[model samples]
Target: MTRHPEVLWAQRSHKIYLTIALPDAKDVVIKCDPEGVFSFSATRADGESFKFDLELYGGILLEGSKINTGLRNIICSIKKENKVWWKRLLKSEGKPAPYIKVDWNKWCDESESDTHDSDDDYIRGNSEDNDSSEDDGLLYLPDLEKARRN
Candidate 1:
């Protein structure tokens, strides 16, 4: 029996990031067509087969799409033909499959996309001229007792 791997997706206006979570996958095959069809298949070391097909929300630039296989996941960077934000990942969506999910870590809101190129940029912007000795962008809250004393 074939299994569907968990897929996480995030998008920028011009590109989509698709991540297939399958550790130690072997004999992987991925295909993306200009008509917005994305297909993937792979086998695990134990001989279990995994596969899925996604009809993407919009047409893609086939020549610009890329795939990278890693020990933990396969990442596909798909360039959009129209260079606009998609309403959702799948074309025929009522609700997406259970295995598919939004990649919150990589997701940037359309409103914020212009202000920050990425999460790192937002962090860096917050940290600029930070009074703390540590250069980490995280804000440290003052202790309640210390604030009360002051």
Candidate 2:
């Protein structure tokens, strides 16, 4: 399977949802079960290919570990795509699905050629930002036990 142009990206949250147009094949493979270890290929209509296999956490985490690693890899991969397909997807679609929004200024900087290291840096920064926001969210929410008792 080759990565399709349709796949602007994917999010492996409670469930895996892709911001991609449903391929003619109707289903896309996700490496969620084994957690951080996964391999899948997608093909564009023109036969271009994108394949990924991730073994994050040194391949030794439990279910939560898998979920976190999978999510990280997925976002990093999409960010490397330069967000070009995202614009195309928006132009042809019903509504924009949530994708890890890329920082275009940093992403397409003239000093940087597209490369894995740069993308990794971006992912690291993005993850930090996400953590801060999630922390703020927790502060505003009622305690889980109290809510459950209510």
Model number with the top lDDT: 1
Off by over 4 Å in 1: 116-150
Model 1, global lDDT: 0.77
Candidate 2 local lDDT, 23-138, one digit each (tens): 43222355533333534555444456655543322222233221112221222222111222122212224544343233332333232333423233323322433543221101
Which candidate has the highest TM-score of all?
1
Per-residue error (Å), model 1, residue 120: 6.7
lDDT of 1 at 68: 64
Residue-level lDDT for 81 in candidate 1: 95
Assess the local accuracy of residue 47 in candidate 1 as a C-alpha lDDT between 0 and 100: 99
Q: Which residue pairs clash within candidate 2? A: 1-41, 1-42, 2-42, 2-43, 3-42, 3-50
Model 1 weakest 10-residue run by lDDT: 132-141
